[model samples]
Target: MEHPALHQAMLKSTFYPGEAGPVEFHETHISRLYLTHDHVYKLKKPVNFQFLDFTTLEKRHFYCNEELRLNQRLCSDTYLDVLEIRQDGDSFHLGAGSGEIIDYLLRMKRLPEGRMLSNLLTAADPTLPGEMERLGRHLAYWHRTQPPVGGDENADLERTRRNWDENLRQSAPLVENLLTADAQNRMREEVEHFLTEQAPLLRKRQSTGQVIDGHGDLHAEHICLTDPIRIYDCIEFNERFRLADRLADLAFLLMDLDYRGRRDLSAGVLQAYDETWGTDLDAPRLLRFYKSYRAWVRGKVLGFLAQDPEADAATRTDALARGRRYFSLALGYLCRRPSLILTCGLMGTGKSVLAAELATALGAIHLRSDELRKELAGLSPSSRDLSAFGEGLYHREATERTYRALADRAELHLAAGRTVIVDASFAEKGRRDDFRDLARRQQRPLAILWLNCPDELLLERLRQRRGDASDGRPELLAAQKRIFQPPCGESRVLPVDTRDEVAYNVQRIICHLANPEFLKEQP
Candidate 1:
């Protein structure tokens, strides 16, 4: 159906009434994008794929409304509303009209293209770090508030597994045509190994309620770093594609960073995420696996384009090269695992100082519970009321909630293949047990460094502390001392004296983490 009436309705719509000229319509493979000077309107293409359905006019209109509704959760200001295209005799008009409806479009306020993170990164702006870190905080906030999709864990895992398997199977034929026999065989073996190794972890993630409907496509191109750092163009067509393991969502950024040759920036983003969320044992492995998966998916997509009969020879060759590059990047992350070390102690114990140094030394994820707690509470660490020790701020219940939140975040990070340094008091036996269990479950090495000092020294340090990220007050320290449950017989604790120089204390923790067995009790 040509639907000229729908096109006329869209063009004459009052959605951008004050704009200077006629609205320009741009069509992508999947959607029709109408751009005015002040707004951008998108309508789903009337096409049905195995993964996406927008075959009928009604379906397209429903999804257009769905996009508007879902996107408003994050970018309420930008995603204005869905406008209706109404047919009047031979022509159509937008808005609530008394005529035959033909189509719908999700209207959004236009943003400056220059504000995109991808563009800023390309321009080599130094402010990119602060911008990305802010984005990390925004993402962390969104993840915390987003409702979980309730479903059978086994079914979800199987569904995800089948999707991944299908991607690999689809790409296998192309790989055969593109590579030498030896290379093809090697790639097949690697894919098989990856599937087998990651299957159980994927299951664990779903069963533990870690799978959620996340921004399906998270990459530099999709993220616009405007004032509020708007993340637009989320996958709205397919639930299966969008509902995913959280680690998979994070992997997009990691892969994008690597693709851009900014591993340092990637590291910083992960660190900021860890600080806001929590530490994880499987982070390094998960990062590698997800990065590989994202790269493979990209490679598979490029391979499809390469095989298109309409593609020019140059375009086909370029697509093939892109596929090969991503494939290599995936293999590189899979080849090695990084080491992780956790710093555990009470407030004013120099744990943060030590953790920061260790992170610099080992390029680890420096996760702090204080930062995460602040994030969860929807307050900054510097917020005066954060340490009030009352309802919703600081108390037994609040602390428990914070620790659980940290544990959840830690697990996600661990799954992404990053070494993590968890900076927390570990003041409770139960809390310590949780970390130990996480390490054991993930099959990753775990070490705990207990910073200790004389009461006088600790008191002095606490008193001298200026504006800090932690919520520990002198009064809270007194309470902590009273209730603190130190690591016991079963706990693996590496004790470090805080009275020593900062560098010396950090070095001691690093040495112990390098070889945890050295810190074990001598028989």
Candidate 2:
């Protein structure tokens, strides 16, 4: 900033190599980026933070080379080299030409601006879902090839403890200013309990190479949807953040998508990722656990930006609001008290669809009665034996037994401080009453989302519902309608029309969860 002549020379196209039209300068919280016609140069700021040190020229050069090497693994064509800036008496040069070496710049080929993941997401492109599938497969193979750094279970667990402790310690000062004490308490308590209870499982993952070197910052802005998806800007100064559980990596992207209000894409991406790799990484509430961590990290960084002395007043104010938003997102992923959400209606009212969508949005456990009933009856979930209405596996006794098991699983998860969403056809009053009693005894809040549809729509849906876990048929609708005892006077019931968009319905459900009295209605 002091060298006005050097800065002016760098801005002109003449300073760059081979016909660069003009140079565009951009700055982030830690780095300065200069974009030429076909190439880009990045210079790290000489700033020392608690997590990273780039205060010395030597340290900056080391990290520049490190960034080049690490990023080349995923975006080989983009990362060219770490070039040196040299200086003479009263002038500075871009390349390794003469005089004394002043600084280092990570040079790269400029990628297409249109292909950036963040831009495409904002445009609401339909092809993004297929791109995400490809990206997931790419990440799966990339994950397999990563070098495992010290794959000792004990060491990994202890390191995890220290990392979490450091996060809590650093963010403690902004308890009331950035986030509420209740939100912080929930995060600290749930994280500790999860780490302690699932220590063996987590350590097993470490022993196997599921925990390895990963892209520390997997934000959408760092990804490009090229012929092969390119992910760049991995943390090079700190292996402590880069080396982590693979789920934590996925959690970063998932949390980023959620923060951007693209949970639909996040859900699809997870499905593809899980299908390509295994689902061993998906523990109960584990994604949310890691997601909360990722969101908190973003919030903490934003807090730093807000307090930066060099930042403008407008920039600081924007950072403060965005930081609080990130903290709120983190809080949404945690539960101070577990909740029991039941989805009950006739068979064809879109209960399963809503349940899955809601669970993905809230990171809650989704239990479907159809699957559980088949599991109990020792039948394949896809096997559809439409025995006479209310007979066979759908018999009164068998149905009650399945509901009891469903309730049992819900109770287990709720007891462990996790929210549960149970999808079932609560046509009989006794089953509904049983759940109400369970909620009462557990001392947890309850909400029965009673899905409703027109008779013709319900019949049409039942007729067209094929290859599903449900054995319901159009003929069974009349029987169900007759037996269905609507939650007419129940204070815990909320009627939901199943014809809405999943995203809108998810937001409605989230709002309802935050304030139960927001939209109470009898079914």
Candidate 3:
């Protein structure tokens, strides 16, 4: 296939030493790479996208050298050298041939196919968790050894802000089509607020040597899970991209893990990094700011690929899907705080189901009072010895202890940097108020989801229920109805009808959670 005016003949096995086979080709927005048996050669496309320019022969030559130099910092054994594609009368040869230089190529030893972290993750490899932890430690060592990038602090902050500005500008075309307009607006406002409020932290990091030259395009795809686990293909075209607060570099990988739905891996990586440095410094604001920005940048990059004219329809469709995911992730990062979601309703209203669903959707920790109460009473989760209200484990004093334990468990989860959902009937107003006080004391956002259903439907569901953690029965529904203090006049309370279609209910809940007002404190 002809690529960048290079014909198939130019990729003959004879062009390089110890290489044989038809070349494997890969193309990105700015470069085309050919992977031979032993080595890979990357050729810059002669296109000047405003952020990067490789249009001229000299510019390509410079970027090729720059790429070779920069990538060697992390994968020294992989990046070999930059070679010129010399031209003869009718053919092109790699390396120093007696012909005019037509183009330049960055040459490197080819990594094993399907060995990248991304591939392994996609294949659901069982060993990835340990490998990811090692990767985090590796990054920590690299950051510790590398000298920090020094320059004007104010200018650096502005440069970081411009990255977000550029992302919003590039993603504008996707509004109302690939991404929702409301999401875009909310993200923009939240990002701006974060950058402004956290400016001091950014400056402090720079002043304290926390800003370092680091791998800019750090994601699973660029990481080879070999013995040494080489991470290659750093940002070589722009120094500004490569030089930033070390946390920003780390956030890129975290964002990738989040995008891949690997919250466990992400947590492991962060924990390992913190342990390696022996620091318990809390940087949630910085983490969220950078993660949101990185996700948006990923979306913008995918959008560019989707819009590329040369991509096939199938490829474009896949890019669009991936782009939407990244944008959604960005929005999620924007709104994600260590918050509490209380699923409040009488029995058979599906509060537990809704809580579980929401927790899975947001990767939040789901805490069920039934399970907690059983565990507290030294009973198995499945063991059900039904007792009347105000007797045995259901006694007033025991129930109060159970609620306190639940709130304590929720707080622990929140402290560990996770959103939490507490599933309980919350029949008593005092219990609900206790949770509200807990949230206020912690300064954590709280949303109460009150489930509603017709009494007949509730009875029907209770009758059909086979196995559940809850002990509610039709006999107790009357007492629950009498004592249940449904959420009222609370701005953070979102009342949803469990009798409605599941999809509709889920959508409404998601929309409510995404609303900034829902995250605010209620009057």
**Top model by TM-score, which number?**
3
Candidate 3 per-residue C-alpha lDDT over 1-523 given as tens digits, one digit per residue, 9 for 90 to 100: 1343454754677776667888878877788888888899898888877689888999999999999888898889999999888778777787885988888888999999678999998998999889888988988888898897878776568879888787898889877556666666777777788778878877877788888889899999899988887999999888878788888899999888877878899888888888887673646768877887898888878888888888899998898867766776666665565788888888999988777656644677889998898898898888885777557778888788889999998888877878889999888777888888888867788888888889999999989887787788888799778877777875577788898644345435555666767666552
Is candidate 1 or 2 superior in TM-score?
Answer: 2
Kindly list the per-residue Cα lDDT of model 1 for residues 23-141, writing each as its tens digit.
Answer: 88877568888888888988777887767888888888778877877777778899998887677787556678688777777889988889988898899989987876887777877
lDDT of residue 73 for candidate 1: 72
Q: How many backbone clashes does candidate 2 have?
A: 0
lDDT of 2 by residue, 1-523 (tens): 2345656777877877685586899977678888898988888888888889888899999999999999999999999998888789877777867779878889899999899999999999999988888877778778878877675687667777788888878777766666656556656776788799878877887887778789989989999999878899999989889888888888899899888877778877787778778776444457777888898898888887888889999999888877766776676675434678898898889999888767754667899999999999899999887688889888889987998899899989888877789899887677888887887777678888989878888888888887999998987778778878998877787888878644345545655665534323222
Reference-based TM-score of each model: 0.61, 0.67, 0.74
In candidate 2, where is summed lDDT lowest over 10 consecutive residues?
Answer: 514-523
**For every model in order, what is the number of clashing pairs?**
17, 0, 0
In order, what lDDT does every prediction score? 0.71, 0.80, 0.80
Model 1 ranges off by over 4 Å: 4-16, 22-25, 176-188, 198-200, 311-317, 337-523
Clashing pairs in 3: none
